[model samples]
Target: MDLLSIKDPSFLKKLSIKDLELLSKDIRKFLIENLSITGGHIGPNLGVVELTIALHRCFNSPKDKILWDVGHQSYVHKILTGRASHFSTLRKYKGLCGFPKRGESEHDVWETGHSSTSLSAAMGMAIARDLKKEKSFIVPVIGDGALTGGMALEALNHIGHEKKDMIVVLNDNEMSIAPNVGALHNVLGRLRTAGKYQWAKDELEMLLKRIPAVGGRVAATAERIKDSLKYLLVSGIFFEELGFTYLGPVDGHNLENLIENLNYAKKTEGPVLLHVITKKGKGYKPAESDKVGTWHGTGPYKIETGVIIKPENTAPAWSSLVSETVRRLAREDERIVAITPAMPVGSKLEGFASEFPDRMYDVGIAEQHAATVAAGLATQHMKPFLAIYSTFLQRAYDQVVHDICRQNLNVFIGIDRAGLVGADGETHQGVFDIAFLRHIPNIVLMMPKDENEGQHMVYTAIKYDDGPIAMRFPRGNGYGVPMDKELKEIPIGTWEILREGEDAAILTFGTTIPMAMEAASELEALGYSVRVINARFIKPLDEEMLTQLFEEKIPVLTIEEAVLHGGFGSSILEFAHSHQYFETVIDCLGIPDQFIEHGGVNELLCDIGLTSEKVVEKVLTLTREKQKRV
Candidate 1:
């Protein structure tokens, strides 16, 4: 059958096991070919081909809800649910989303990008179903690695206590972006190798019955021996004790086994945890061998050779520059330590970890715990460098505010991907950090214009002893500018004048600085002198420069690659208002009050009018207003 022409998974129920196996091959071929061009969560999707097919065969979707935890592995589900035709435009702007989108298809009942949310969402859906007298199966396919999340554990406890009618599919691939850690992971490791427990339990029960009840003492002894068997044979007793009936260490790749277990789960009363073991990147050779999680998500690649297609001689990634700088400083400063919420590779902290194994901490997927851990480190006069993605940092907002900022601890937060992160879509965009963090007291938020400034900002953040300091950098490579022989710390709250002019001022920082400079140059050609200032420190407004601009009566245009509300630009506006400089004409350009979708960064910038063209237009408009006032 042609994969693209598939309208629904209803046909899957009619197909034989042999035909389903052939269909799985076709689906894998389709994904390997299409994702090689468009690029997506290839490893994850490949791993779930049979599992997804088995699920659709076992359940009636749209009626019986299937929620994918993290949703990166839902590409196979998408293909089966009439979305194979959209593969070419996967993760592109105004096209197919990388994650499950409720608006895209009726089959996609739950949307997810972050991990550990499916169990909680499933609980809510289960409650609603019971309240409405609805009869439908609720299955939440969560990964074993996601189970380590505090929220997932909390939901599990609640789910078991309530005994809601739901099937929790634990897709144990033994990885969540990177290798899973913690005691829960160890428990799963034992389960994975322990094989099926039901057979052993049955044999033990048969032997116990044969032993007979001779007397009260003998009966009690038999009962104790039977209970001890659970400790030895029942690998999933951990979940069983929590009120869920545990099934399998089932083979996820086996269609027959998956279908059988799923059907059993549907028939079972209360909650059931169907543990299905899968291999990440099961089909593709290169992805299957990926130990460091580079193939977890990727750009376009050569499918035959497994070679990633990237631009030649790209500048160092911002993450590497900042992380390496921290590593270098860590050598001199014994007090410095590195911490990440399972993002050592993404944050480029592998070097730091390797160099100072004792000092580096990979705190699994617990962002809240990581934040508080940094605060704890700071209280002991240890400089804790908490490296986290801006989007994930939102999960630890309370910790950042209460534990770190409130006590004014000396913590260095390396906010990676601190702007519009393309390809991962709306959920992974780092545009809200400025809006969320700028309001917190004793928290210094700053971004850098280039890799050189980024390195300096790292130095400044680590050197600053007053309070909690965060330096945000965008995703992808730097501009490849020439570096200085020595590193230096920039003064806090001081804006740098990249280009001096008399007529108007363009204030911006980080990735937006180049756009501002380009716009200023364009204005210069049209006989409009536009001054470009790098307002790097987002929290602390550059008061001296603001006073100068206001005194000169020069109109200001603030540009940021962040949300407009309460962002860097908002800080400038608030400064002008507080200082009583009411006549100063200020225009702002940034991400509008909407979530930006996955696409090329430049395309996203253009869509939101954060390009040089928009800056020129805004500068022209602002200058015209200044002329009118004059």
Candidate 2:
């Protein structure tokens, strides 16, 4: 039980394969117990326990590189590599990282969080080793779903063609957040079936070769016949044709089989593909049965019932509202189609998928392909709604610019999780879309004040056959506003003033509108009487109202949850300079030029001075500065 007291891979290396299997069970139990309290990635870590054990036993890590793609499954790797004692502090602030941290241990050769990047990083490490003439094996453990990403495929093509000395361990878990999709998933299925038959036929041919007096040339012909049989039976010559040696569809759970196969691959030359099948939640009952999208990544849950215990409220989440409304609209409209880059469950598109199964497409971890495909669908005059997280959308910027915007097609981009997503940290925050998407030409961007406005915006986007449009909404629920059946479209490139005052103005968009309101109310109590305007449309300026505000000679304060540079605040300043309203004071409040760390959403906001209290302080400071100038 005292895993750290024992030596690491040295001790693991001494154990028999059966003992290692027992240790795998212990690791799973330990992960379940500790992660129940810490709320780390329990399901993924549990699933990869046996695989991690087999990997360490066979490969000499810290010498032979092992890179884990998407890194959430690295918990077992960390525990095995002498951090078992620190398991209690996993995902805690400054305690231990949820993903693989390069600084945490030398054994973790590469750090990763975003999916589909392991192969590329592995290739870099492999090339370095080769240049040094070091014979260390480079193995990248990539999941079946991660292979769907464009970057992973590109790396695969390059590595295969270049004939690099690397081994790709394809962990086919059949899921990635949601189930895997696209052509790669189909190819892996064929490879698994081919591997099952190929190994059997090879054994039969070896037996025939043992038959003496079958002439030397005949034996050579038989060997060629067997080789040809392999090519005929296996349709997945995709990797082989690309130049990499294909070697698997191994039993990932079976330690002996995995060890034998991995040992063989290690001795082989050039890039090799080892296909290994695994279950997402191998030992856990509740997680194993969670096909409806509950166990991929979970919060704190009861180990017995697997019931999630987060603070629950019945208010409709923004994802559900958007999906439900879209499904309702698509009931009559046949041209409407829904798409996500492998996030039907996370984006709450389950309703749409069920109702319009033929119309919905889950592209599987490929954001670039999703955008371009949506563009192609739009070209056919079919209204394609591309549902994606704001952060993930950053991955497909080129597609949005070249494929979608350049053509000026009718594509509705539903940007969900459009602000600070807590716990998952900097890599997962959806805070930069307004800053990035606003500047792109032929792109109309909008964010809703509440769920009602979100519905209206969805309707507006589908009806306007002009060009590409995106509507961003925050992660959680709305402001408890009532819904309506009849939808109405708000005018594009415009803003609605929520509250009016003469002393100063507070301009904002999306969820920050509530924060701005709270700050304005607090300022009013202090006799400041600040104006609060909801600038829903981030791109096109509401020039008519802004000009009148400038004429009033009142100071303007812009607030957003995005970066300050090249954001809404910057646009207001540019407008002020163009109109020569230098006499009117202008200020901006937003996230500073630094990556925010992981914490509770409210805690993070207060720490970064984005809270209502911070906003009030900013307003008072600006007012005093203006008076000092006078």
Candidate 3:
């Protein structure tokens, strides 16, 4: 059967278990082949093929809302919901989204990209369902890794206490980016061999009955310890204590078992939790053996031999550069420690973890907790490098504010992927860190012009001993520039002049520096003296240089690969006005006041008019506008 002919999950109700198994094989093949060309969360999607099929077959979607936590695993869900033909365009600009998008299909009841949101979203939907008196099942499928999140735990407490008629499917794959850490993961590991939940309870009762108490104080104490023993030995008792009707340790890849368990969950009341154990990369051999998270989400790879196809770039990745630099500094600086929110592989902190096992901490899937933990380490006068992606850092804003910034601790935050990360789309875009982190008091924000500057900035951030300094870096490889033999600490709050001019000024940082230079060069060839300045330090605003620009009365053009609102560009504007430089011609160019979609980085840059062509036009216009004003 043609997988492309799959219209909707409605057709699945008519299929037998064997037919569904065949369909799962087809779905896996479709994902492996298509994702090889397109590049996506193939491992996650492959893992959930049978589980998603079983879900769609068991529950009536659009009416019976099914929410996928962290959304990357929803590719299989999308295929089942009449999106099989759109596989070729997966994660491309204006094409099929990698994550569940509400606009794409009505079957996508909830949109997600970040983790641990499904439970809360499901509770909200369940509340709405009850208020309207609608008869429907609300199922939220969340990974075990996501369960470690504070928000998910909070939601779990509420959902259980409210006794909401919902089914929470805990997809325990034992890996989230890398292997999951924390006590919760251990609990699930023990639960894996503890047999069926009811059997564990009965077995515990049997053991309790045979304790051989000789009618003494020991017998009364033994009777009192019955409930405590269940918490210790019984399977799924952790969820049972949370007021959920615990079910499973069910095999997620098994269609028959999954369907049967899902049916049982539908019949049960008061928020049943079906703990389905799955393999991260179920079907493909290369992905199946992924001990690290290389296959979690990947670029285009060769299907036959499982070699990920990447362009030969001599330049080191931004993540590797920063993490390696930190590791280098950690050898000399005894106070330095590392923390990441379940992104050891993504952030390239494996080297750091290997070198200093005691100092490194991988706090799984809890960004807020990771931030606070960094803050906690800071209180002990320990230099904690809180490595996190820009998008995920948004989740820890309050912790950053209340704990890291408000307390004025020395936490060196290495902001990874600090620009428009192309393929992962809006939810994973690192564009808003400047906008969010800029306004916070007692905190310094900066981004590097290149990998060489990035390493120096990492050194600078570590040595500064200032109140919460963050260095933002882009996602991909650097410009492959010559590195200085010795590392140097750049003076805080100072901007670097890459090229000088008199007609106008182009001030930008990070990935946009080259664009600024290209625009400046074009303007110069056309007989315009455009100065290109790398405004690396986002905060403090290079006031001395701004004064010089104001005194010279040169038209200023600020560019960034970030949101325009409250971003670096906005900061430059605010400085000019506040310092009584009202006559100074200033223009800001960046990602417009909208969410950027998934595409190639260059394609996204062109789409948002962040290219050198756009920069040249902006500069020419600004200079012309200034000439008229003069």
Q: Write the per-residue lDDT of candidate 3 for residues 116-146, one digit (tens) a residue.
A: 9999999999999999999999999999989
Ranked by TM-score from best down, the candidates are 1, 3, 2
Query: Once model 2 is optimally superposed onto the true structure by TM-score, how far is the C-alpha of residue 259 displaced, in angstroms?
Result: 1.4
lDDT of 2 by residue, 1-630 (tens): 667654467677888988998998888888888877878777677778888898998888889899999688998888888898887666655567777878788988887778999999998988888889887988899998898898998999999878998889989888888877778788888887776643565667777778788846557798577667668778777777677767777888899888888887887789988888888888989887777657878778899988877866667889988888889889989999999998999899998998899999998898999999999999899999999999899999999999999999989999999888877777777878888887889999888899988899988888878899999998888877888879988888889889987778899988888899998999999999898998998878889988999988788899988888888899999999999998888889888888765667787787788889888988888788778777
Reference-based lDDT, residue 613, model 1: 91
Q: What's model 2's TM-score?
A: 0.94
lDDT of each structure?
0.90, 0.85, 0.90
Count: clashes, candidate 1: 0
Task: For candidate 1, write residues 234-345 as lDDT tens digits.
Answer: 6647898898878889999999989988887878899999989999999999999998788998989998899999877568999999999999999899999999998888
Candidate 2 Cα errors over 4 Å, as ranges: 3-8, 195-226, 232-235
Cα displacement (Å) at residue 177, model 2 = 1.8
Question: Candidate 1 — worst ten consecutive residues by lDDT sum?
Answer: 211-220
